[model samples]
Target: MSCRTVASFISLFLATTAAVQAQTELGNFSNVARGGVATTFVTDFQAIGINPANLGRNDNARVAFTIGEVGVGVGSQALTRTQLRKFIEDSGEELNMAQKQEMARTFTSDNVLNLNVDATPVAFSVVLPMVGSFAFSSRQRVTTHLGLNKNTAELLWLGKDAPIYPANFNPATAPLVSEVLEGTSIQMAAYNEYNLAYGRQVLSLPAFVLSVGAGYRYIQGVGVVDVRSKDGQLEAYSALSPQFNVDYGSVVNNPSFNLQKDTDKLLQPVGRGHGYDVGIAAEVGKKLRLGASVTDIGQMTWEGNLLTANDQKLKRLRSNGADSYEFFSELADIFASGTDSLFQYKPAQERKASLPTKFRAGAGIRVGSRLEVGADVTMPLNDVAGNIPAAFYGVALDVKPLSWIRLSTGVTSGAGYGMGIPVGFAIATKVYELGFGTRDLRGLLSDERPYASVAMGTLRFKIGTVK
Candidate 1:
C-alpha cells in the first residue's frame, strides 16, 4: 500500500481506539537535579549534558552514577452548593438515591483524576582529565514511566449502559459518546539519551582561564499501549472480527478490540531524534567560576501506516454480537456502507517529533580553601507546540570541614513558583570518596509554603584517583 494510504489507516485506528491509548508526558526538567552541586569533581559527564564548559573545571579523573525518582500530583476542589441547588430546581423531580450515589462518586473521582505522575531516572557517567586541563567523558540517561490512571475510566464504565442517543438521535449525542469513550485508554513511554564529549582549556591569561567544548547526542523514545477499551463493547467487537483482531495485537492471546483498528496505526513509527551540545566556561578570578551551554537543537520525524477494520457482522447484530462479528475492511467501503468508521485516516496532517532545546548559565565563588557557593539559571531555548516552558534557578553552598568531609546545601526554583531544597554530604579518603544527598525537601512543608513537594536521594563512590 502507498504511504499515504497506510497513514490514513493508522489515523482511523487511533480515533477508533482512542480509549485504549492514554496521553504521555515528555521533556520534563526535574531530571536535571540529579547532577547536584558536586558535579564539579567527576562532573564532566553531567557537564556535557548540563554545561559543556564544566569539563574544563575538573582537575581529577573520576566516574559517578546517580539514580532518582520524581512524583507529582495536582488536584482542585470547589464549593458548588449553589450550582447543585440550581440543578435540582431545574429538574422536575427530586434526584433518586441512585442518582445521588452516582453524583457523589463522580465528584470525588473527578477531583482525584487531575494530574498524577511518577517517573524514575537512572544515569551513569565516566570522566578522565589529562595533563594541562583537558578532559573527555561519556554519559547515559534513561527515563522510565510507571503508568497513568486518569479517573475518567470509572466514570465511562459506570455510564456505559446509558442510551447514547435519546428518541431524537441528535448529532450532538455522537460527540458526547466520543468524549465518554476517550477516557478508557492505556499509555506508556520510555526515553533514553546518550552523549560523548571532549573539553580543553583554550586560554590561561593572567586575568582568567577560558575553556570550550562540544559533543554529539543520540536520543530514542518508544510508546506502547498495553490495554484499551472504548464505549463498552466496541473494542471487543473489533478484536473478534477476522479483519482487525488478526492484523493488530496478534502477538497477544484473546485480544479484545475495544477501539477501531485505525487507532493503533496512528501511533506507529515511535519517535526518534538526535542533536548536539556546545559549552564555554571561564574563571574570572582565582576563586570565581562561570559557565554556559546549549543542548538538543534537533528534530525527529514520525512514520507509520494506518489500517481500519469494519466488522460487517456488527451492523446486523446487537449487543455482544456487534463486537464479535466486526471485520477489517477498506475505509472507502466502510464509508459507503454507512457505518461510522472512527478508523479512517486524515491524509493531510503529519505528526512532527520535536525535542526541547535548553540554555543554562552558572557562577561559583570559592571562599578561602574550605567553602564555595554557586548558582545556576536554566531555561528552554525552544520547545514544541503545547509544550510548557521550564525555568530553573538554584544556589548551593559547599563546605570542606576537613580534607575528609564535604557538606552542601541548596535551593531550586522553577516555573509555577515551584521550589525545593537539597542537602548533601560526602566523605573522602586518599583513595576513596562516598556521597549522599536529599533533594526537594520542600515536600516536608505544605503547599502554602511557596513550592511544590519533591524529594530525591543519591550515592556516588570513587573507583580510582587521578594522578
Candidate 2:
C-alpha cells in the first residue's frame, strides 16, 4: 500500500529491459530483424503487419506455420554497452565519486531510451490455387519510449545532490516542477492483437505479377502510460490493467479515486479496439519486387484504472539518488513515493489514444539463387504513444552460401536511433526452419553506443508445395 506500488510498476519495466529487447514493428521474424528490411521481404503470416500482399507471392510453400516466436530489444542514448552490461550484471551497485560525476554528465543530454518485446504465440497461413492466400495470427507486444531533457535528467540522476539544488533549498520555496523540467516524457503500452488477412493475385503476365491484400485486426489493450512535461506544464495520463497491481496508497481513499481495483486474471485487458492494414505488391520477372503498406489505422479507449498527474512544486526528497542507471526507480521516487512524492494524482473515467501507425515501402531483388538484396523506408503517420519518433531507412542483403543455410546483414539509420549493423543466420529446409538474429550487431561486440536486441524462432515449419 506504499508508494512502492508505483515503484514496482516502473521497476517491472526496467527489469524487463535489463533482462531482455527494438521496435516491435519487425514482429517475431528473426530474419526481418536481421535484415532491418521487411516491407517487401516478409511473406505468409509474417506479412500480417508488414505487407499482406506478400501472402499472394509465388513462394514455394503452400502452407506455413510458426508458434512461440519472440524478440526483445533495448536501447539507450545515455548508456553504453559496458554500462548496460555492468548494470545487468550487478544492478544498483554503488558508484565512485568519479563514476558519479561521469554519470551525471552523461545524464545531462537529450536522451532516448526504449524497450520492445514482440511475441507471436501462433501464426498460420495457406496458399490456395483459386482462393488466393488466407492467414491468421496472434501477437503480444510491449513497447516503451522515454525522452529526457538535460535539467530533468540531471535531477533524476542526482536527486537532491544535483548541483542545481541550492544548499539551503526548501521544498516550499522551490520552483514549480513544470518550470524546471521541460521536454521530458514517457510512454509505455502493452497489447494483444489478433489478425485475419487475405491476399490474391490481381494481375499475372509472362513478365509481371501483381498482388493486393487487406487485413483486419482486433486489439486488446493491456496497459498504457503517456506522460509529458513541456512549456511550463505537465500532462500525464495512464491506464493499467489490474494485473499490474498498482496501489495508490491513501490516494484510493480520496474522493477522485475511481480507478478499477479488481482483477479477473493476470492478462486481463483494460481496453479494446480494431485496426486495418492494406497493401499492394508487384513482381517484375524473377529478380525484382516492390511493395507498400500502411498498418494500425485505429484507436483504443482505456476505461480501467485511469489516472492523471497533478503537477505541483517539489515537497520532499525520499532518497538521495538512484544507485546506478536505473532511472525508473528514481522517477518513481520523484513522481509518486507516498508522502514524499513531488506531485499527486487524480482519477479519470476514460481516455482514448491512437495506435502506432506507419507507412512502409520497399524494393527487393534476387540475384541468381544465392543472393537477395532489399531496401526499405518507414515513415510514421501519427505521433502516437508507440510510434517511432522519426523516419527509418535500411538496406539489407541475404547470402545463401549453402542450400540450407542463409546469412543476413544490413545497415540501418534514423528513427531517432543511431546507425546499426544487423546480422543473423537461419537453417532452413523444405520442411523446417530455425533462426536467430540481432537488429544491431554492435550491441554484442562494441563498447560504445550499442543497441541490445535478440530475435529468434524455433517452432517454424512449412508443408506441402505451391504446385
Candidate 3:
C-alpha cells in the first residue's frame, strides 16, 4: 500500500483500543486493593500466574480451593453514572438541548475513557512436602476505551439544519473551526486463559531461603474490535446491527470511510496459543521478602472466521451540519452497524498475534506481627495485540488485627493512567475467604470526573479451605 494508505491504516488501528475483558497484568481488584504489590503479600492460590515462586510460601496447609472471583472497574471522563442513567435508564426523561450541550462540552481531542474486568470462577492448589507447590486456575480479562474528537462533538451540540462548513470558517469573526475535525473510537476486546503454576525451594542458607518456579498458560482469544483514526479527511462509521443499519459521516471532499462488521461471532476463540511465566523469590531472615518474574513469552494465530473492515468508496453525507450532536452520537456506535454506509467489511483467512510479555519485581517487609508492607513494579515488555497496559508502581500495607480479619490499602499508578489510592479488607477462616477493593479510588473521592478510573473485586468471594 501507499504511504497515505499506511498512515490511514495506522491512525485507524490505534484509535480502536479496547478489550472484551480488560484487566491489568496484575489481574483482579483484590490484588489492586493491596496496591497490586506482587513482590510479596501472596500466601495462597492467588500467587498463581503472578509470581510462581510465591506458591512455596503459602504457610497454610497442603490444599486450597477457590469457588469464584470476578471483578469489574469502569470509569470515564466523558460521562458519569448519573448521566449514563439519564441516557439509558430514565425512560420518562428526554435529553434537552442544554443537557446535550453540557455533555458535549466534556469531550476534547486528547481524551480517554476506559473499563477493565478480570475474573476467576474456580481454582485449586496443593503443596507436596518434597514435590513443591502446584495450582491451576482460569481467568477472563477485558479492556475498553472511549474516545471523542472536536468535529464529532460539534455535530452532537448542533444540528445539520444549516451549512456549518463554509469554505473558510473565519475564527476571528465566528465561533467555529476550519480544520478537519477529529473523531472517536468505541474499541474493545476480551479473552480467556488457563494457567498452571509450580514452585519449589531452590536454596537454603543460614539467613535466607530462596524458591523458583514457573507458570504454563494457554490462551483462547474470543473477541476483538479495532477501529480508529488519527488524521486525514474526517469521517466516522458504525454498524448498529449486523443484518440491518449502517451509518457514515465524512467531510465533502475526502473519500467517505466506511466499516461493516459482525463482531459478535468473533467474541469466541478465533485464536489460541500458549505461554509461560518464570519467577524466583527469596526470604531474607524472616521479616523481608523479594521476588522477580517474566511472563507471556509466546504468540497466537487467529485462523477461524477472520475478518476486516474498510471504507474505500466516496459517498455523500446527509445535510451538511457544522455542529450536530445527533450526527456525532450516531457516528460512534460499537455494535449494530447502521442501515446504509460507504464502508464495507470482508472476512479474511487468518492472522498472527504476539502475547503481552511482561517483567515484574517486588519486595515486602513485615514491620511486626500485625503489620506488613511491600512494593512492586511491573512493565509491559512487548506491545501485545490485546494488551497495552502501562508500566506500574505500587506500595501497599496490610494490617491483621485478628487472625480472621485483614485490612489493606496502598498507592499505585501506571497501567497507562494516573495515581490511585486502593483500600479494601478481607474476612477469612480456615474454610473460606471473602475480600473486596478498588484500583481507582479517585472515582470515589473526587466529584469532578477523573481522566481514568476503575472499580473491581469489591464483591469477590472464594469458598476454599486453607487446609
TM-score to true structure, per model: 0.53, 0.90, 0.72
Q: Which lDDT tens digits does candidate 1 get at residues 1-467?
A: 12122223333333322322211122112232221332232243445566666666544346544444333322122113332223223334444436533543433321211222333354444554453333233222211111112323222222222243244544433443234333333222223455666667788788788878776666544321112234442221111112222233332222322222333442222445687778888888778888877766676443222222222221111111011101112211222112233232221122344555777778888788788788877777753321223566778777789978877677866522346675556665544445544444553344332212232333333444433
lDDT of 3 at 296: 78
The number of residue pairs in model 3 that clash at the backbone is 36
Off by over 4 Å in 3: 1-29, 58-61, 78-81, 84-105, 109-111, 149-186, 228-268, 310-343, 450-467
- Candidate that scores best on lDDT: 2
- Model 1 lDDT, full chain set: 0.40
Residue-pair clashes per prediction, in order, are 28, 4, 36
Which ten residues in a row are the worst by lDDT in model 1? Answer: 317-326
TM-score of 3: 0.72
Pitting candidate 1 against candidate 2, the one with the higher lDDT is 2
Per-residue lDDT of 119 in model 2:
81
Task: Report clash pairs, candidate 2.
Answer: 21-72, 21-73, 21-74, 22-73
